[model samples]
Target chain A: MTSRKLGGHFLSVMTVVIAIVVFFPIFWMVLTSFKTEADAFIYPPLVVFQPTLENYNIALAQSGYFRQLVNTLAITGFSTAVALLLGVPAAYTLAFHPTKRSNFTLMWIMSTRMLPPVGVIVPLYIIFQNLDLFDTHFGMILLYTAMNLPLVIWMMHSFLSDIPYEILEASQIDGVTLIQEFRYIIVPLALPGLMATILLCFIFTWNEFFLAFNLTITKAAPLSVFIASFKTSEGLFWAKMSAAATITALPVVIAGWVSQNSLVRGLTAGAVK
Target chain B: MSTLQNSVPTTGTARPPDKSYLRQKLARPAIIYLIVLTQIPVVFTLIYSFSNWNLLRPDRTRFVAFQNFVDFFTNPDMPVIIRNTLVFSLSIVLFSLIFGMMLALLLNRQFRGRGLARTLLITPFLIMPTVSAVMWKNMLFNPAFGLISSFLVSIGGPRIDWINTYPMFSIVVIVTWEWTPFMMLILLAGLQSLSQEYIEAAQIDGAGPIEIFLYIIVPHLRRYIEIGVLLEVLFVLNIFGEIFVTTTGGPAIDTTTLTFDIYKEAFLRWNIGRSSAYGVFAVILANIVTIVFLRITRSGTQQNKEAA
Candidate 1:
């Protein structure tokens, strides 16, 4: 019994140490974000330094940071909104109305996600250039909406399906319309799941890079692009890069933390539960 | 009210005619939207893959038939690119899974500040991939003044320039760091779902901790492990941002994956036909994985239904 107690204590301490080691880089980045330029790249990597917001100031001032921030916000917000707008209704239909094609439809929607963006990017780039959608908010939003729609549909479908069909049947009457059923009954029931879906969608779109980098240049480049610009800085701008990276990553990190519980459900498509 | 009377079901079935109509209406927009924005582009890609086209030499464009694909398969660098991609993705997935499971098991135990620990652990995954790459490259992996260098010197070790010396390994480390939390989260969910009675029963039957874990826990986590691995494969196979930001596909094509190869061929080389051919292969690989993933998930769900 005593040995078991000792073992448990040992494991707990080990857990704490490993967690710190794993989390150190992010902590160091946030820490470095506040350090002076010279102090940021010291030989011993200073843990104790005069914290300064100079890096943040420099980072924010350079590279159209404000524009990128706005673009990121706009793109993430609209794409997530549109995905939910389209996904929720479709998910509702699939969950409640079991038509012959419902299973096929769900699979087809998911298959769209599996169509790697790289496969279509070349053609899409050409099309975007020809159609004047290459570097616009509308273009990014359109792409992100498609990127997020399958996720939204799958998550919302699972969430909606979990709400017992008995409740809907219990509430239904002869003359009630489908919209009324959705507006009053399903909406209230699925609100929590909807929030999770929205948060996940927002996070994915906010942090997305591949398409964002390839598709947009200057006019609509989001924060991901902003962060990528510091890639080849060759360690000269460590502090500024940290500050810029911190700014770009913080919101999504917080959102992910907040929705961590539901995140598994969304990510696994409710497979685990 | 009178029109409602006509629409309302007065027969044996309680279902309304308009409800199914509305359901179909609800489903159409998303399907149509996806077809227009996502599927149409792929069709165009297929068409472009067969034609010889270069943005730089537009006048020279013509039907290339199988030439582009032939070039892709026979390219001298094809083997190296394929090897780099396999090594990069497999190492990240395998290492992250091992470490993630260990962390998950540890976190599953009762401990102080477990929530905080989990939160801190998961933060890496939430950071933008670009940010993660730059942070690793500039702050941690730098040979001169990096934390790793500082620590190595203090410990009487050689200071290693991680990115330049071991480009593929460095990328795998960064990506694995970002992905470990993902695996942990799913595995932890699986662990939490395990019934306490099963463990107690094993203990009562004289099973040691390792034996119990090996016998009981591994089997229980098989489905979760499968789901996690498949999902990781789906994402990690197309890893780009970290590679792009860190090595730009290498010091000299050392780190180029199929996705990056396509990107370079199309954008840098202006060889659209060749890139589109590469793109087609990427699509096929993704679809193959997706089909298997869908099968497993479907069967798993069926098992869940049976168990429930």
Candidate 2:
């Protein structure tokens, strides 16, 4: 009993030690963000600081944090909504109505995701320019939606697989039309998956850098671009950069904290239950 | 995409709501907009890929017949781009899977603070690629003001230019930082699904830790490991952001991967035809890789059938 308890305690202590090492960089960055410019670079690096909001003030005031956040929210929300709209039905078809081309189509869509966005970024840029969508929220939304559709469909298909067809057929027999069945029977049953899909797509677009960096200038940049504000020809502004990084990362952190309950199940979806 | 995967509610309530409007309307306002708006960009890209279009002289652009494909294949930069892409992506996939599984094995053990450890492991992944690159470049690896350089100085050593000296190494580090969490999550799921009886039984037989790990964990983890590795390979082969921020194919064209080269050619140089040819090649290569992956791993359909 003593040996077993000792082993358990040793493992627990070891886990905490590993956690601190893994988490050190992010914590240090957050701490550094609170310091003054001089404090950030000081050799023994200041562990305790005056805890000024000055860096954050500089970040928000100069970077237009709110405006950029709105752009990110709108684009991420719109793209996820678009992806879900295309994906859920397509997943339904592939799931319940399996046909000869169904598997191939699913694989093709998945393969489409493998097409390096950069392989197509330039072409898409030119397309957007021609269409007068350069630097617009709408352009980012469309690109992100199409870019994400494949994964969305694949995940939804996986989620839909768990729902036996008999349930759907029962709903159909009870006069539930295809859309009705989808909304009532399918969506409700697959709510966990739908939420997961929406969240994943939203987070993806939320943090996407290349499209935002290359496509938008100042008009509609997200917080991802907001993080790049400290970048300059001379060099980076360390304190300000850390501040920007912290700001950009905070929302996702909070979201993750709140969503942990669902995240576990959602993340492990289609894996062994 | 974790957010989307994360959104599926496990709650069994909120059923039997009126399906009236959902059925009567069958409306997908968002999907229609999604399709219509998306068609413009995709169609325009397809059109431009075929045309001899140059943004510089838009009016003079004309249809070119296979000229781009010939030029792309014959281009001096093509080989380097292909090599760079294969190296960058393949290295990340190999290293991430190896390291991810190790981390998964460690965390899967019964231990306190495991949840916190998992969250910490996941933080790197949640960061934006651009931010991650910039953070590493200036905060961690910058010779003049970076942490590594500062640490080196304290140890009586000269600082080195990581980006200039080893651009691919720099990219690998950033890419690994971001992707290891992804593989960790997948492998963790696989590890959890495994029952503990086999391992306990092995232990009772006096099998050593290393033997049990090799004989028990590795084989049982074969499918999950394959899934993790395949997904990592599929995702990594498309890496772009760190290259964009940290290297930009720099010091020479040393870091110009296939996707990056394609981006530069088509977007920066406005060589649409050449880029598209490369794009088509990329599609072919990707298809081959995924087909091999699905077969080797017995992914999707077979898994579903077994699952059912």
Candidate 3:
């Protein structure tokens, strides 16, 4: 019994230590963001220093930073809303009244996700150029909506399945229309799942780099593109880069943390369960 | 788009008597939207793969009938890029899985601040890949004053230029740091779900910790491990932003994967035909993985049903 207690304690301490080690990089980045250029370049890499908001000032002052941030918010927000609007109905039908083609439709939708963004970028680029959707919010919103639709459907399908069909059937006897049934019954019951799905969609759309980098140049460019600029030619701008990175990463990080438990189920599509 | 606008009110107002029609009405918009956005572009890619259309010399455009594919397969850089993609992705998956399993085991026990530890551990994965790369490149790997370099100097070791000297290793480190959390989360779920009774029974039978882990834990966690690995394979195979920021496909194509290769062929070279051919290869690879992934997840759920 004593040995077992010791082992448990050992494991707990080790876990906390490992967590700190794992989290150190992000901590370092946030810490570095507050230091001056000279302090950031200090030989010993100061663990303690006078903190400043100057780096944040510099980072925010960079051209198009706020515009890029606003763009990111718009793209992530609209795409997630539109995806939920489209996906909820589809998942509802598939869950409550699965047709003969329901399984096939779900499989095909998921398989579309398997198609890497790179495989279709060449044609997408050409099409976007021709259709005048290349750098527009409309174009990105369309793509991100498509991007997140599969996830929303799959997750919401599982969530909706847990809702007993008897509720809807009973409501139907009382002359409840489909929209009313949805508005009154489904949304409230599935609110937690819906929130999780929305957060998942938000994180993915926000952090997406490949499509956003390829598709947008200026008008619809998000913070991902803006952060990539730190990679070249700013010549050792560590503090500024950290500040920019902190800004870009802040929203998604919080979202991911808040939704961590649902994340596993959503990501694996209920495989673990 | 018109279909979307038309279908909404029809579903809301019409009140169809037929249930099947209502089902179709509810589902059609999403399916059509997906088909238009995803399927149509792929068909265009298929069409473009056969032609020789460089943006620089558009007047010379012509359908060359697999010539671009032939050129891609026969290119000397093909082997190098393919090798890099496989090695880079596989190694990261392997390392992260190992580390993730260890961490998962550690965290599986009842502990103080367990929730806090788990929250902090997943932070790297939450950060955008571009920002992760930039942060690592400038703050952690910069030879002049990077934290790692400063640490090395403090230890009386030479300050090495990580990306320049060890490009592939540097990328692998950055990506593995980002992905280990994903593996840990899935495996930890699997661990938590394991029945405590079985472990207690094993312990009563005089089994050591390692023995119980190897026998009881490993067999039970197989599905979770497989799901984690295959999913990680699918995601890591397409790693682009990290590589783009740090190495730019490196000192002479040392770190270029097929995805990056496609980006270069399409954007830099302006060779639409050739890039589409490369894109076809990427599609083929992802499809292969997707097939295997589907089979594994299907079997996993089936097993869960059987166990239940």
Candidate 4:
């Protein structure tokens, strides 16, 4: 019993140590965001310093940081909403009324995701330019929606599949309209799954780097592009860069924390079975 | 596409089921839109791969049989690029799997503050990839006045130029830091779902911890491990921003993966033909990995069905 107690204590301490190591970089970024430029680059990495909002002020004032924040919010919000709008019904059909064709379509949609963005970016860039959609918010929304559609469908399909068929059949026997059935019965039963899917989609859209990096120059550039700009000018400003990064990462970090449980389920949907 | 049509044959002899129209109505728009969005670009990429189209010399564009592909294959850098890609991706996957399993095992045991530990551990995976890259490149890996340098100097050790001295290793470290938590979460979910009865029975049978882990837990978690590996490979193959920010695939192309190489060819060199060919190759490589992964998991399911 004593040996078992000692082993339990050892495991707990190790868990604490691992947690600190995993979190230190992000904590350091947040700490640096509050330090001045001199303090940020100081040798031995200042443990004691006067915290200042000057870096945040400069980053917000000079880098168009607020505009980029708004852009990030708008892009992530609209793309996730649009993906859900298109994906939920399609997933419902696949879950409830699956045929051989439906199964093929689901697999095909997922296979589309396997095509690397690099392969498709060339034609997308050309098409966006010719259509006068380059660097526009609508253009980004469309692209992000397309990018996340497969994931949304896959996740929603898995979630909806868990709903018992008898529930839907009873509703059908009661002569409910299809829309009424979906609005009344399906939505209530699958609400938690839908919420999880939305959160996952939003997180993905928010963090996407390549498409936003390649497609947008200024008008629709999100925080990903904004932070990349600091890379070229990185040597000159450490504190400001840290501040921008903190502002960019904090919201998604919070969202991710809230949805961590659902993430595993969503990611391992078909494969885990 | 043909398979889809065949599955829904349109013979006039028998009317389709009543629910078929409803199914089509709910599902067809999303399907058609995805096909259009995906197919047009793929077809265009296919066409461009065979042409001699340089953005700078548009008028010189012509169908150049297989020259672009031949050039891509023969380029001296091709071997290094391919090697770097495999090494970077595989190393990240391997290291993360190891660390993730360790962390998952630790978290699976009954412990105080387990919930908080899990949340803290997941923070790295949540940070944006670009932000993570920049933090590592500028704050952590910077040779002068960086965190590591500060620590080493204070300890009277040497200051290493991480990106220049060991570009591939540095990239693997940064990516592993970001992805380990992802693996841990998936593996933890798998661990939590394991049946306690078998484990208890093994314990009653006097099996040691190592024996139980090897004989029971490992086999049970195989599917989750495969899912983690296959998903990581899919995302890690397109690791552009991390390399782009830190090394820019240089100190002489030491870290350029296939996607980064394609980006350079198309954007920097403005050689659409060669880049498109590279893109096609990347697609083929990703498809091969995906098909293998699908077959493994499909067979696992088949075995499960047969067992039942």
Candidate 5:
């Protein structure tokens, strides 16, 4: 009994230590966000300092930073909505009325995800430029939609498939039209899954850096690109950069925290099953 | 009309009622959109890989056969970039898996503040990659004013320019910090899903904790572990933001992965053809890894089912 008590105490201490280590950097970043430029750069890293909203004020006041924030919100929101609009119907079809070719189509959709974004990015860059879509909100939205559609379809498909067939069969026998069945039965039943898919898609689009960095120059630059602009001028503005980063990361971080369980499901969908 | 009606009845007798029309109509938009989105760029990439198209020298654009491929293979930096990619990806994946599993195991047991602990532990994975990289680069690893440097200096040790002195290792550390949370969450899910009856049975059979972990827990978590590693590999192989932010794949290309290499070729040097070839190589490599991963997981599930 004594040994078990000792073991329990040991595990608790270990858990706390591990948690602190994982959370420290994020804590430090947020703390630095409120520090003045002088305090932020001070060696021996002040544990307690006068906190201020100066950094946030400056970051938010900057037209560039504010624009990127709006851009990120718009792009992530519109793209996720568009992805679901296209993906949900397709997933419903594949889940319920799977034909001989349905499995093949599903696999093909997934394989498209395996194509390195860098591989297709070159052509996309050229095409976007040629079509005068470069650095435009519409272009970013289109690309993000394409990037997320497969995952959305796959996740929604898994979720919709889990709905009991009996319920759907009953609806079918009641002389419900296909559109009505989808609208009334499928949509309501799959609401939780749809929410999960939306959250996952939003998080992904919000955090995406590669294509956003490559495809946009100024007009459509999202938070990722905004933060990246700090990279070149990092030495000069450590405090403000930290501030910018904290602000840039806040939305997705909150989204991630709120929907972590659904995140795991979305991430490990096909792989787990 | 009579012949068609007869055929419909015969077909209904031969097979299940066909839902082709509805299914096709429903699936068509997504399928067509995805094909246009994915196929066009892939086809363009394929075609461009064979041409001599430098954005700088547009007049020199011509069909170059396998010249770009040959050049990319023979480049002096090719081997170094490949090695960096392997070491960077493998180190991150292996360490994250180990740390993740350990954390999952620790969190799995009943402990005080378990929910808060789990939330705190997952914070890093939630941060944007670029933001995470910046925080690490500026706040923690900055040689002069960063936390680590401050600690080192206070201990009377020399300051270390993390990115300049150890570029690849710095990248690996930053990436591992970001990704470990993801692995832990997935493994934690797997761990929680395990039946407690088996562990209780093992304990009653006088099996030690070590024995139970090795024999029972490891086998049960194998699928989750594989999933985590494969997914990590898929993402890690394509990591660009961290490297780009910290070292810019520099100090003489010490941290350049294949993705960064392609970015450099296309954007910096404007070597469109060579970049396309490199891109093709990356695609092939990624596909190979993905195919093997799928095969392993497929067979693993099949075996489990058969045993059941």
Candidate 6:
């Protein structure tokens, strides 16, 4: 009993050390955002300093943070939602049906993921401009959807694969249509995985800077481009930059915390063998 | 022929009214979306690559066949950019894999607080690339007041200019920080899945741990390593956030990789034609690499699984 108790105690103490390293950078960023501009760069830095909201005020008001927040939300939400609408059916097809083409299709989608987005970024950039989708949410949404669709399909397929074939067969025997089985039985079983996938896709979309930075000059710039507001012809505004960075990363951190368990499981879900 | 109506079973139970919509519910939405949304980008990108069109030139954009490709290959900066990109991506992949495997192996040893250590290691993976690059550049690696310099002085080491002095090395270090955990997570999974019976048997047969590792473990890890490397290489190829934030392809083109090159030509100079050429070239090169890797992996993956 003592040995078992000691093991538990050891793990708990280990958790404290982990909490330090894992939480430290974020802790420092948040802490630094509150420090005055002068205290921010001071050597042998003060752990404690007079907190101020002035940095956040500058970032939000003068930095155009609010519009960028909207752009990020729109693109992230729309793309994640749209990717699901396309990928769910594709996943359903692969799960219920079998053909030589099934494997090929899966491979094709995965192959797309393998290519660096840079490969197509310029073509997409020109395409966006020619089609008048430049600096537009719809344009960004479509591109981001494509960006994430393969992973989405892969996630859905892996999650769907875990459900026993018998459950679906039994549902069919009980008079459920293929679509019905997917709608009711399959979806409920895959809910946790679906949520995890959506959350992850959204985070990637939200965090993405290159596409958002290049594609949208002003109209559809996300938090990434918005964060660049602190950047200008002049040097970076450190306090204001930290404040913007802190604010932009807040959503992802909160979502990550909410789905920490599922995030881990979902990430490893696609690991074959 | 099948119906949701028939799916409710024959237990003398009443079927729901909505059971008849099965056949109507097809993947039309998905198919339409793929054709309309995805096909456009794919088709447009292909088309633009063939034309000598710059976005800024409204009326003078003209069709040019293979000129983009020719120009890309012959461009003054082409070789340098290609070399830098290859070096950056290859170095990141190599180090991340080697260090990741070693770390995974070490951390796999039953130790106190491994779980917490793991979470800390993976935290960088979840952090946005832009934020991570910025954080490292300013707070950790800045030559003037960064933690690296601060630590160096504390240890009687000299300060090094991470950006201008060693731009590529700086990028590699930060990327490794962010991606090594991804590799470790994968290798750890593969390691955990490797059964102990074989090792025990090998030990009984007079094999040492090192021999068992080389003979048994190395062969088994080949596929996982391939997969891990492939993923890392692919991500490194598209790395835009770090270059954008840290150095912006500076110090006289030292950090100018393919993606940054495309960005500079297209957005920075508004030269859509050349960038599209770069984009197409990117597609071809990426395809070649992936095809080769897959061929290599198809065999190794089977062996990898057998060991698992």
- Report the number of the highest-DockQ candidate: 3
lDDT by residue (tens digit), candidate 2, B1-308 = 78754654443344445543343222244334434544344444555567676666678788887777777778887788778877888888888888787778778877657878878777787777777777877777777777777888889998987777888998898898788877777777778877899989998999988999899888877776776676667667666667777877776889988777777777678766667766666656666777766565446447757999
What is the lDDT, from 0 to 100, of the residue B54 in candidate 2? Answer: 68
What i-RMS does each candidate reach, in Å? Answer: 3.2, 5.6, 2.3, 4.8, 4.6, 4.5
Clash count of each predicted structure: 0, 15, 0, 0, 0, 5
User: Residue-wise lDDT of candidate 3 within A134-222, one digit each (tens)?
Assistant: 99999999999999999999899989999999998888777666776787799999999999999999999999999999999989999
lDDT score, candidate 6, position B114 = 71
Q: Label model 6 with its docking quality class.
A: acceptable
TM-score per prediction, in order, is 0.95, 0.85, 0.96, 0.94, 0.94, 0.85
> Is model 3 an incorrect, acceptable, medium or high docking prediction?
medium
Candidate 2 predicts chain B with a TM-score of 0.82
Give the distance in Å from residue A91's predicted Cα in candidate 4 to where it truly belongs.
Answer: 0.3
| Model 2 docking tier (incorrect/acceptable/medium/high) | acceptable
Our tally of clashes for model 1 stands at 0
lDDT of 1 by residue, A24-111 (tens): 9999899989998888877666888889999888878875998999999999999999998898998987888768988888888888
Question: B1-308, model 5: which lDDT tens digit per residue?
Answer: 78644543222223225443665567778888888888899889999999989999999899999999998879999999989989999999999999998999999988778888888988888899998888888778878777888899899999999888898899999999999988998899889989999999999999999999899999999888888898789889888899999999998888899999999999999888999999999888888877767676567657867999
Q: What is the lDDT of residue A82 in candidate 1?
A: 94
Where is model 6 more than 4 Å wrong at Cα?
A1-27, A50-63, A177-180, A229-236, A254-269, B1-28, B35-39, B56-60, B154-156, B201-209, B292-308
lDDT of 3: 0.89
Model 5 interface Cα RMSD in Å: 4.6
DockQ values of all predictions: 0.60, 0.36, 0.67, 0.47, 0.46, 0.33
Segments in model 4 whose C-alpha atoms lie over 4 Å from true places = B1-20, B299-308
Residue B249 Cα positional deviation in candidate 2, in Å, after optimal superposition: 1.5
